[model samples]
Target: MPSFAQILIALGAAGGALAAPFANTTAAAVTTEQRSAAQTFTGDITYYQPGLGACGETSSDSETVVALSPAQYDGNCGKTITITKDGKTATAKVVDKCPSCASGAIDVSSTVFQSLADMSVGRTQVSWSFN
Candidate 1:
């Protein structure tokens, strides 16, 4: 037969082992909650040239172009879009669609382009994500 002290120690060890799984599960839940709170997703796209009278004389650098599926062009004009260029991010509404876009470039306004990246040069590398 085991002594009383030995029996108590064995019970304590078994209890801890059983609690391990629950502790791990709680930790995982906390991590998932934090990730959901900090969720920020971004989409990648290209930049294209703007059309005449697009943004009312905004410079090339401050312009952006988003491809529309014909119907989405005029209907979703005021939809908000968050654009991240270089390291800066700017939020703007979808105003116009570039009819001359190459394949996957979405056109934006000159002010937005300038706020997000340097438009002085021809084109800039940008990553666009919406939330």
Candidate 2:
């Protein structure tokens, strides 16, 4: 006895109600992972020229590319990291390995380094985590 418009409205309402629980579950999962993914550590950060890097990736100043220590690079290649310093933060992709860097040092592209600190500073203490 319900009209076509009424039937569609009822179906839409039911569909929305059914989808709400799934949506909330997905949102909760994402929030939980984001909370756990943040692991902070202090390190020395410096800038480098944009060019071919040890990971065989060609980069430029315009891109947010970063070089990690050999150990970090082995596991983090092609992953993103969020670096923070002097109350500023920048996110960059791990694209290369830094054999010369100390165990906790990281080298970022000129743009990413500048985002966290002035180029004249050359190097600064930074905290970073995988995003």
On residues 57-100, what C-alpha lDDT tens digit does candidate 1 reach at each position?
A: 33344444343323334444545556666667777555556665
Worst lDDT run of 10 residues, candidate 2, spans 32-41
lDDT of 2 at 29: 95
Each candidate structure's TM-score, on Cα atoms with residue i matched to residue i, is: 0.42, 0.68
Q: lDDT tens digits, residues 1-131, model 2?
A: 99999999999999999999999999999996677467576789998886887767899889999998875677577889988886788999998888888876899899898888889999889988888
Off by over 4 Å in 2: 1-38
Q: What C-alpha lDDT, on a 0 to 100 scale, does residue 118 get in candidate 1?
A: 63
RMSD, every candidate, angstroms: 11.6, 9.0
Q: Pick the candidate with the highest TM-score.
A: 2
Candidate 2 overall lDDT versus native:
0.85
